[model samples]
Target: MRRALNIKNKLSFIDGNISKPTDSFDPLFTPWEYCNDMIIDWIQHSIGFEHRLTIAHADIATNVWTDLRERFSIQNAPRIFQLTKAISSLVQNADSVSVYYNTLKSYWDELEIYEPMPLCTCGSVKTLTDYNHRTKVMQFLMRLLRLYSGSGSSI
Candidate 1:
């Protein structure tokens, strides 16, 4: 949603960069109101029917965006656990190398979404990312080794 709003040049509406004019006498009030209403409508249409009522009474785009974010951005532990289990149990088996790698990559991508790396300015983020990639590569190779051993082949 942020990307979509950014693409449309309306991210400022929800990001609070463009404050609404309070006075009706202000010349900016009319244009601000129009843009706010449009942004509110865009948000309303993007959400589910069950969630529409929660933001229906919100007049400000920023308020609506905040409400939705607060409601849905909680960490999902169960999903993270499921993805972790799947990644640990996955094996190359009879699948082609590309197929096995793609499946593992998808699992890793979703798991990262749930447990994203922390932002840092100490220049450790790159080191952490490199370490994570190395770990994933080791896991993939270990699983492939099992497949080769079971097939009477030496790696």
Candidate 2:
């Protein structure tokens, strides 16, 4: 099925052309207006992906989860997988959320840590109260994490 567009954080560039901003760090809870931080832009520009590699998807995944968790409780497996897959693809063309995060890790690892860097922002769907697609995906991520880590599970 065709995915919904990330309307809120869609790149601000108009007419398909705009110069990069000087700052690369992104503001918390805000759409990425512009980045003065060269490396973040470079990753998005030169690498052709917001993620560095499969491992680097953490930044984006974590943020997405955190956003959802603020409102509702997360759910468990299978159903969660479905949700995650949808959200993951919606964010980028990743095979899975894990792959996406790892990809980002790969890119981030290559960068120097001297400066604060922001991950790819997909914008807020919190306002889209009419739909629960985002919430479903977030619940799936929480289950995947719990299953893998065994921390949220009871014996």
Task: State TM-scores per candidate.
Answer: 0.69, 0.16
User: lDDT by residue for model 2 over 76-116, one digit each (tens)?
Assistant: 44545554455454432434657755554443333213222
TM-score of 1: 0.69
Among the numbered candidates, top TM-score falls to 1
Supply the global lDDT for candidate 1: 0.88
Write the residue-wise lDDT of candidate 1 on 88-139 in tens digits. Answer: 9999888988899899999999888778999999998999999998889777
Task: Report every candidate's CA lDDT.
Answer: 0.88, 0.37
Q: On a 0 to 100 scale, what is the lDDT of residue 14 in model 1?
A: 96
Off by over 4 Å in 1: 89-107, 138-155
Scored by Cα lDDT, where does model 2 land?
0.37
